[model samples]
Target chain A: MLDTYKKYFRFLVKYRGMFVLFVLMLTVLGVINAINPYFYKLFVEALPEKNYQTILNILILYVGVNLLETGIDVIVYLLGDAVILRAARDVRERVFKKIQDLDFAYHMTNSSGSLISVLKRGDLAYFGMFHELNGLYRILVHLILMLVMFGAINGQIAWLMGASFVISAIASKYLLAYNLTTRKAFNKQEDNVSAVIVDNLINYETVKYFGKEVKEQRRLSKAFVLWIKTLWGFANSFRLIDIVIGLISAAGLWVVLHRTFTLYMSDVIQFSDFILILGFVTSF
Target chain B: MLDTYKKYFRFLVKYRGMFVLFVLMLTVLGVINAINPYFYKLFVEALPEKNYQTILNILILYVGVNLLETGIDVIVYLLGDAVILRAARDVRERVFKKIQDLDFAYHMTNSSGSLISVLKRGDLAYFGMFHELNGLYRILVHLILMLVMFGAINGQIAWLMGASFVISAIASKYLLAYNLTTRKAFNKQEDNVSAVIVDNLINYETVKYFGKEVKEQRRLSKAFVLWIKTLWGFANSFRLIDIVIGLISAAGLWVVLHRTFTLYMSDVIQFSDFILILGFVTSF
Candidate 1:
């Protein structure tokens, strides 16, 4: 997997300067996502003082900051497109060239139907991998920024949030792996189904002469049964993750809300701080 | 489009009882989504009183509601899978039969590469359409519930939200249509690229005899260039929508926050109400 990622990175760096700009823009977007909630805290704090001018100014600033965030997001999206699309094109071209260069014996041995399916999926996988990793990177930045803000308010509460995130991450790793396994099984079955269709189309004359349309449909129906079963397993795994992670997060939320409420009661924090904490946890 | 949806619904109703259960559970899930935030308002209200027992009870109740939501979500996912998977299988089987039952001349004219691609995409379209419609239904439920809550507080604010939603939806409809056009163009180019590859593999013997591997590579490169162009167009269309909608929402946010802040300053509502308004808007 590391080797695969290294090759992906190699393609990514084909537009080295643009890729750097994309990363920087993404980090800015993450900062914006994290800090926007802080403005709400500002609003809540300003409300008690009847500071009309200050409140209006904060609202204006809040909207200004949001507009700026949107601007950055636009740039990030464009940069992401420029980088990922070029890299994807490079990957596809290389894959096509490599396939063309393969030994004749290899081509003869491999069914073109399955080979084409693999090629198509490989093309899609490149795009999926880039976006997934890009999203993960942004999320990491947002998480760190949020934790820092949480720690600034109250260290124990931040610790509670961090611990819960760690537990959730650990659980997600296993659950997502299981999901991937089932998904891979389903993909294989899907490929078989497609292969059946492609093969049937390729041998249409023979099938027409043999009058085996019903037989072909029966064959596809059989493939559909197993395909459906694997798909259910894949779908069920997703819900399993949802249930387990949902409960875990609920527990975390309960503990955090309780801790913050206690802090508020003891006068360790103001009501604004309480609202901010609530906003952050719920939004996250 | 109506006929298409009618066909989809016909397939969906194959598992009549499960489909009804799925829709009911989905509605329940949407209510849960909309109502959960009211508990935050309750928390804020309780904080001012320092009502320890009430706060603890609310906390417990919040967690319990979340647990129930998660439980319902699990059931919904399972039911969705049962309904959608079976419906999709039926659709696929029917499409396969229809295709097989077509004239041999039709099969002769259509490249199997593109035909299989169309079949595969059609199969996927069913699943995608189901999920997209289900999500839209949930959003509709959540939005109605939220608007009612907002209206109960301030009719003007509710009107503002409703107007913003309408504007955003209108903008999204046009932008998404353009995005779809670009996406369809890209899909066509992608099919062309794959057709080149599949045709090359099918006609390998003639290519090998002619030593035309480099020519095949050139053909694929040409297809890749066009495919990349369409993809960039599609990606840019999405960003256009994002920028427009983001700014519109920011403007809406500014107006609502200012109005709510003014109301709070005038003693028309409590700090908790301010917090609740901020919470709802930001989270939504």
Candidate 2:
């Protein structure tokens, strides 16, 4: 997998311009998003004070910022989509070409499904390494910037948020790894089920003529039941991860809220600052 | 497409128990979500009085509800996954059996690649239709429930939300349809590029022995250029759609904000109600 990712990255560098544009657009969008909470804070503060002019300005700014961010997001998505589609197409074409050049003995020894699986995997790996990893990198960059901004506002609060994020990240990584394992198992089980189903359906006439439909159905059902059990296991595991993450997020919010209240009561934070913290925490 | 959907629906219905359970779970989830805002409204109303106990109770209730929903979601996902895996396995087995029993004349008329494509399309269609349509239906159902909840809370505001949702839905549908067409075109162009790549690579040794490397490179470059051009077109089209949809969503949010401010200024809505309204608008 690591080697596949490395190779895919090299392939994508051949069309660096498109990817650079994608990254640039994402950076712009991230900056805009990071700035949005401040605008909301300003707008909320202006609203209660009956500062009509300030309210109007803030509203316009909010809309303008959102529109700008949306435009950047659109461009970023398109660039990423183009890069991935092209990469997948190119890689798949190369795989087909490779297969065609392989010796006859290689062809005879390998199942067509296995070859197709290889091509599909190659295509998927390319997409993940280029499109997904790039997106992940962009998000990480933006997250760090946001954390810096939060730290500037209140270092203690930022520390709390950062800790929560780190914990969640670690938990998510473990969950994802587990999910990957289960997903692979589920996929294999599904493949078996498909093999069985297809066998029965295509040989329906043969089975019926042989008066073996009942026997075939029983065999298929047995495989299907096992598939169901595997699927249930996968879903239950994912559910636990999701629930834990949600609880962690809620706990983080509670801590932030308590800190906000404490700071406000101690006259260390203004209402506007509290609102800003709330907006940032909620949105992030 | 309608026929395809019908066929897929029939296939799903063949596993009626699982299908019904899936729908029921979604409906229950939708109903619960529809009612959740009211609880928030009640909780927020009690907050200003320094009602920590009620707030804590609400928090606990919120967590409990969320966990319950997650539990149901997992079960539904598991059930659906089981059904689909079984269906896929059945189909693939049937296809394999068919391939084994197929006459020589049939193989002669159809290239292995073409047959593979057919089997692939069938398998994908089976799984895609099952999973994608289920998701689409769930969204539609959730939207309806949201509408009902919004209408119950405030009819005029609900109408405004409905209008924005309609516009967004229309824009989304149009953009998706356009993207699908462009995607299909891009696929065809990529297929042609793949064909050319395969032809050249398979005869690479022949071309090298005949000192035709430069000619082959030129030919490959021609195909590559066409592929790139097609990619650019797809990118441009997708970008246009993304921009349009993003703008629509922004506009929708703007309308919601305006309605929220109007209700708040008129003193007809509490903060909790406002929060609920925000949730509904965002959900749309």
Chain B TM-score list for all models: 0.94, 0.79
What CAPRI grade goes to candidate 2?
Answer: acceptable
* Per-residue C-alpha lDDT of model 1 across residues B54-114, encoded as one tens digit per residue: 9889888877888898999999989999998888888888988888888888988878777
RMSD after Cα superposition, model 1: 1.9
Candidate 2 similarity to native, TM-score: 0.78
Query: How far off is residue A256 in model 1, in Å?
Result: 2.0
In Å, residue A273's CA in model 2 sits off its true spot by: 5.1
- Cα shift from native, residue A181, model 1 (Å): 2.1
Best by DockQ: 1
Put down candidate 2 lDDT per residue, A154-207, tens digits, no spaces. 788888888888888999888888887887776666656545544443344576
TM-score winner: 1
lDDT tens digits by residue: candidate 2, B191-238: 555445434443445665686656655565576776777777777776
True lDDT of residue A29, candidate 2: 70
Per-residue lDDT tens digits for candidate 1, residues A93-120, read 8887787778789988877777777877
